[model samples]
Target chain A: MKAFAYVNATNEREVVAALKTDGIALPLAGGQDLLARMKDYIDSPDRIVNVKNALDTTVTSTPEGGLKIGAAVKIIDLYENQQVARMYPALNAAAIEIGTPQIRHQATVGGNINQRPRCWYYRNEEFVCYKKGGSRCFAVDGENQYHAIFGNDGPSHIVHPSSLAVPFAAYGARFRVLGPKGDREIAASDFFTMPTLASVLKENVLEDEEILTHVILPAPGNVRSGHYEVRYKASHDWPLAFTTVVLTMNGNRIGSARVVLGAVAPVPWRSKPAEAALAGKPLNEDTAMLAAEAAVSEAKPMSGNAYKVQMAKTAVKRAIMRAAGLKTV
Target chain B: MSDKEDRFGVSRRDFLKSAGVGGLATAVTSAGVTDVEAQAGPRVIGPGDVPVSLTVNGKRLELRIEPRVTLLDALRNRADLTGNKRVCDRGSCGACTMIVDGRTAYSCSTLAIDVQGKQIRTVEGLAGANTLHPVQQAFCDVDALMCGFCTPGFVVATVALLEKYPNATPEQARRELDGNICRCGTFVRIMEAAMKAKTVAGPPTRQARWGDMGVARG
Candidate 1:
């Protein structure tokens, strides 16, 4: 690996100041992804701003009865956090579903949510696709088995890799961001964007000078949430398709619902049709099947990823059923 | 330079003539090989070397290494502790598994500087002079190791699993060991060893085990 200058920023101001400079400063949180990329020569930043020492790693309860998860909170911490387990079990399950025990212990929650796309072509550093500012997307005609099926409008087909972000969006979590201007809050749903709308080279709306501070989850009440993932293999592999659902039930009938799909779209694919199908209806096997069908109505599968449609349907049905405390069919 | 070489050449022959008598005198004085053949020169520490202090096997070691050196490379190269093998330099393989601050981590993927003050336990640190660690004993009893190349990592990972979940069921053990891979296909034996270790270790303290395989309550 090429040698680079390592800078340990003392505070948010120092981090933003360093990021403002022109020399390509990469922020290092858990170093789970950044260091690997550096070793592979995929990213050779001249300087690395170490944020592990700058941010707090604690997970605390907010005054509003929600969780305030620091950006540096490790994935293992999230999996074992008592408040997170009680308030958002789906988030905990999603955290556990990421990588392995070692990666979980070292990877931070903020890093996981902001991780680059896991597209094979983008990660290889050899394929110069449209996401890398090239003329065309390699996955469009090449190996797209893991590409998006829902939110691909053109030039890029990479899917968002964060399992936690799906549940975050389902729960309507908000992000606390720090930048050169000042601190600002953005909803998690708006934080992740599509390639067609945002810059093709970037995955989210985060600027190079900004740092994600913490994630704020609302207070738990009548909300029932769960996440289900279907993957080829369970170990250190990205999910083929997954679903996260948050439902507010009026006794046995669903009052409001939010269904989000992961690894099947450019962003967490929020299915309004599925949400509409669940509203004002009892969460039964038949209703879940209808919701699942509605979730995949607009899915346009690539050449090798038609099987993911089935996987996504199954995941959505299971997630909704689990959230409703119903058994799988 | 020529004059210096001529002077050194004459002194070398004179010194060699007296070296045999001096060698015998020194050997008699020290009762060992006094004129042993020269081996290799010492390795030089480079400018990029940084001082790192780590606690390994309940012992503190201060080592000088490059900032980019990984924990696996430091343990295997500088410390001469080769138990943690580096199979896949990526985090996919658990060949470089080690317990860092009571959690299992891939040493190959972890930077040495990142774990400055953490307690690191490698496979070599598991056994004493007379007794083996419980996990190691179980692995041996169950014949869990084939080819033995991945045994050290598996043993270390098992130790971590047992530490976190003492009463892990067979299915929980399987899921917890998912991070570890055995190319020799000793997964069944490894799982057996893990279950046996859980039986010997008794119940977990307070943490609940995740995954559908185990129905154990916290």
Candidate 2:
């Protein structure tokens, strides 16, 4: 990595001020993503602001019976938090399935959500894809086995890499961003923007001078949620595709549903059709299969990723089954 | 040049101005002694070599290095502690796993300066002068290593696991050790060593810790 200055920020003000510098000043939380990108020369910032000590690291209960999780809370703590396990079990499941034990012990929630896409073309300095200021996405015509099947209408074909993002969207959480002017809350579903020709360099709506401070989850009332992931390697690998389902139950029938898919889109792919299929219908094997089929009905699979369509369907079906307390297999 | 100028011939005032730290500089220069820290912002350290202190194996080691130096590079290249090998420097492979503040972390992805005040433990700190740590001894007794490039990280990770869960279940052991990879396919033996070490290994006694060398003498 190239030489850079370090800033040991003590608070949010210092963090924003440090990043407001003339040179490129990036926040360093956990260093799981930023440091690796630096080593690969994908990013060469002049300053690194250490936010591990500066940001809030606790999970507190809001007056509205919701959770306000500080950005610096480690993934392990999020996974083991009893409140999260009870209230937002889909998020807890997603947290536990992240990278590995070592990664969970160090990586922070903010960093995980803000991590760059793991598209091999973007990671390798040689390819210089659209995410890297190049003309077009190499995954368009090149190897696209792990690329997106949904939301590929954009210039970039990279998948959003955060496992926590799907559940965050399903749980109706909002992200609080701290900036030089002030702080603002963005709905989790709207936080990630689809890639455009102009905004291909970034995945989320966070500005350079801002930091994501907290994730606020509204109270889950009368809801059952489940998250399921499919990966080639059971030990440690990114999921081929994953799904998180939040079903609002009205006695025996489903009142409403939120189905979100990951690794199949540039953003967390929310299937309105699947939600419509599940509404007012009793969750059974047949209904679950219908919802799964509806979830992938619009998937535009690439040359090499047609298999992911089936895997995504399986994940959606299993997520619904798991939410309903049924045998998925 | 005045004493305020850095080695790069840029005056501190100009440097601060160019770096957009004029506000912090004004605050630091104008604030009262009691109110200084409240007004002052984060202090910028190196784009050059700067002093960094680390507590490794219960001993403080100091070095002057550029801010980009990772903990793995600092320990292996500067502190002469090379037990933790750097195989995949991007934090995928766990060959550079180290225990920091009672948790196993990827040292390759961790900056040396950022971990200044944390207690760091590596594979080198596992044994004492007279006897090997129970985990190390178990690895040998079970023949859990073949090529051995990945052993130090596995040993460190295993020690952390056993320390956290004395009688770790098979699933727990698998999950904890999943970050590491062994090309020689020594996993069965390694798993056996981990289970055996759970029965034999206890917390390191006072005698089981190295005095100051930060390595086992044997």
For model 2 the local lDDT of residue A203 reads 81
TM-score of every candidate's chain A: 0.97, 0.99
Indicate the residue-level lDDT of B132 in model 2.
82
The first chain of model 2 has a TM-score of 0.99
Weakest lDDT window of 10 consecutive positions for candidate 1 chain A:
A16-25
Give the clashing pairs for model 2: none
Q: What share of the true interface contacts does each candidate keep?
A: 0.16, 0.39
Query: lDDT per residue, candidate 1, A125-214, as tens digits?
Result: 556455544456889889899999987786688889888899999999999887655778999999887886236766777754678889
Evaluate candidate 1 and give its CAPRI docking class based on DockQ. incorrect
lDDT by residue for model 1 (B112-174), tens: 877888999999999999988988878876788989988999999889888888888776676
Q: Quote the lDDT for B155 in model 2.
A: 97
The TM-score measured for candidate 1 stands at 0.86
lDDT of 2 by residue, A31-83 (tens): 88888888876666678888988898999999999999999999999999999
